[model samples]
Target: MSLPDMRFRAEQHLRRQLDFQHVRTHGRRHDCGAFMLWYARQAAPIAPVAAVPAASTDAVSPDGATPAETAPRSRSHQKKSASGPIPARVGVVASKSAVGNAVQRARAKRRLREAFRQHQLRVPAGYDLLLVARSSLNRLEYREIERRFADACLKIFPAAKA
Candidate 1:
């Protein structure tokens, strides 16, 4: 089968340390054969903007609108209210203590990432997902890893299936 055109952009990943901590603290957990999935429903954080100075009354437009009034709303807010379901984001953790050597940890993380990349569409939106790898994960075949990951996703999001 041909691979889908979808790309795993940085926006789709859990990049912030706080985001991972939030999921670990508030999310529910699901365990598969070689991995544990932690997920929580939380609003995506808004990017911080430098505070703009208040416009003076004299700066008002001829149409009686301030610059702020004419400015467009944030796209993130719009995305939160869009009609369709949002895409699930993921964070993969394969620590040295959990997976031994650096090479093994890298391999384990890569496997987890590939599985998530393939099946991320099957996952529902508005969730922060974290995949913690077990030592056994390195020994598993790619297909087995994929199966376990998919099963974990299904268990967490039973209603996401079409």
Candidate 2:
């Protein structure tokens, strides 16, 4: 049975080679023993607010000289404003050289993804995470893997919300 909290949304998935490369290039790294974690916070997306045209220039008077042109500016337009924080995204990597044969690599990645999915909320918003599996990953118990992931979360995001 799939739990809502454990449902890995598409938005929360890190796809595309560029994104993977970006996280590896600029993100901070943490060694979880069985895996290496790399994470970087992304900037939130901002929606631009349309500006209202300054009260139409005092309509042309008979003289044609607009009063607005003559009057000292009394007010300025308010600054444009509006505020996706893209949901936290995670990617798993289990290379042949790192995690062994195909079956082992797949298992390692699956475990890592499942672990991240279950406690993803513990991670703050707008972060890109990469979990690279090691050969040791397959040898570890699921509970131990989960615990290490939790500890890694704490060390990486010390102020993470409960």
Candidate 3:
């Protein structure tokens, strides 16, 4: 049987410097054997847009005014509402002080990313997560690393609410 697409997309990652700083400053942290997990619940999902009728040229405003009479919504507001909820994002930090040379650091990141990608569905939505690698991470096998990550996620996010 063909497995489902599980590729990690850029949108799924915690990319912004501000996001990282926010998590660092305010998120709760959990220490697994090989790494530290930092997480925080994000804001509520955006309100879904109302469906527009294809045949209607003139849309009625919510306040009982014509479309032209109503003030146009800002572009940023439209974009924010269109994009919907931000999914659980993950950021991996493998510093030189913890994970040795560049190659090792990259390897650690790759392994962590893979583990997160495979088990991301189990993790609850709407959390910003940061995983900081430790020196001991290099010694563990990939399976062990994945197991550690899964355990950490379970501890950090106990019940996966629908």
Candidate 4:
């Protein structure tokens, strides 16, 4: 299949400067802690990194309302999907078991891409994103995958003042 042209359309499009391969390489076989250190040491640190905000989770609200105190929260965390500045790139790692067949794997990937496309607003510009799909994706709902993807992005790129 032809890969999408993830090129930067405008100067602000992160697709121009993002290094999807680099993010994946740094994250290979490593956890978030290790990844964070690797980022600090690397010459080309992932640009425009933002830590996932606590508010993004089901925690205290900006107004200090507990989950019980407020109306049911929207599934914002599960909604985050893509990461990058210009042509924001998304990485995928599917388990060999769940999506055992080539067709299933492709389907899973398509769903992931759709998730990314739907949540472009949450992702900031000019950043590289790596997505590691858990084996359970075959069983998990699409929204769950989306949420986890966003959380992972936030973990990798915390929202500090730019």
Candidate 5:
């Protein structure tokens, strides 16, 4: 698949430290044992970043912003995707301390991403969600994690279901 075909759109990622901080400070937090889910509604649309393939760029950083995300690069060669940004901006975190070794952390993150993508539309637009992985993430089954995520979205973002 082409880069744009697999586009996870830069705007849908919580690419700035300040964005993560804002959600943590002002958003509501829900502990699902497997992960901590943080939700905040954006006041208005933040300026959309140029379309870039997420897989080619950065990993989750300590400050939450990767150098790729922070650095301003030329948009001259970039082709804008026909689609606009989705309402939900999501950040997924898996700490070595909380989630264990590299392999385990990766698995947790992978599961979390799959769970979110499967239930993406369940979350309304303009809402930011941060998913921080816990130790339990690896222990639980993928279905269980998915169920928890869906349940959380259903309860918190019921507008989608309505």
Candidate 6:
């Protein structure tokens, strides 16, 4: 059965939530390995920060701005999933080199992808993500991987509380 929906946007205020496996849960694939965090909101992309001169004039009065203009706009589909900004990614470290074989790698990647698909909602709409396989992964059973992966997902994407 589906556990529940938890996403990054669902929890952005807490500081401690930005670490690896700070949260826990389970997935269908191998136990979760760990999670890496990222953010899509760029303070400065192509524009140089230094060039951002101080406002030449007093800011527009709040009364002048329209209500609709103040509302948060819906994100485009590209920024919704893989296309969107990836705030978090995960990596599965194999425990031993013996587990690094091609067959093992495929198994691990499959497990990772499977886990991701099962809980894609944990991730926010905008965020870049990459899952790496580690050597420590070989020793753990798939269930363990699932648990770890779930934890990582929660860390990246927290669930909405009722």
TM-scores of all candidate predictions against the true structure: 0.74, 0.71, 0.71, 0.44, 0.69, 0.41
Best by TM-score: 1
Candidate 1, 1-162: lDDT as tens digits: 986546776656887688789899998899886989888986555755554655674577679888677655554432444555556778999988889999999999899989988888668777888999999998999999998888878777788853
RMSD of 5: 11.0
Higher-ranked by lDDT: 4 or 6: 4
Q: TM-score of model 2 relative to the true fold?
A: 0.71
Give the Å error, residue 2, model 5: 21
lDDT of 3 by residue, 1-162 (tens): 977557787767877677788789888998887998888875333555544443455766678776545544433311232465556779999999989999999999988888889888667767888989999888999999898888888766779631
lDDT of 1 at 33: 67
Superposed by TM-score, candidate 4 places the C-alpha of residue 123 at a distance from the truth, in angstroms, of 2.2
Return the clash pairs for model 5, or none.
87-125, 87-126
Task: Let me know the TM-score candidate 3 reaches against the reference structure.
Answer: 0.71
lDDT of 4 by residue, 1-162 (tens): 975443432332223223444554553332432111112112243334343445545688679866556654443212233553243445454455645677767767666666556554445554444444444555767777667655555565576221
Where model 3 places Cα greater than 4 Å from the true spot, the runs are 1-5, 43-84
**Superposed model 4: Cα runs more than 4 Å off:** 1-20, 27-85, 95-98, 158-162
Candidate 4 C-alpha error for residue 69, in Å: 69
**Residue 52 of candidate 6: its Cα lDDT?**
30
Model 2: per-residue Cα lDDT over 19-100, one tens digit each = 7888988899999999999999753334454444455665665677675555544221111223324567899999999889
Candidate 2, residue 144: Cα displacement in angstroms equals 0.6
Model 3 residue 145 distance off true place after TM-score fit, in angstroms: 0.9
- Candidate 5, residues 61-160, lDDT tens digits: the string is 5789875766556532122345753457788989999989999999998898888877877888678899999998888989999999999988887778
Better of 5 and 6 by lDDT: 5
Model with the higher TM-score, candidate 1 or 6: 1
Q: All candidates' lDDT scores?
A: 0.80, 0.79, 0.77, 0.46, 0.78, 0.45
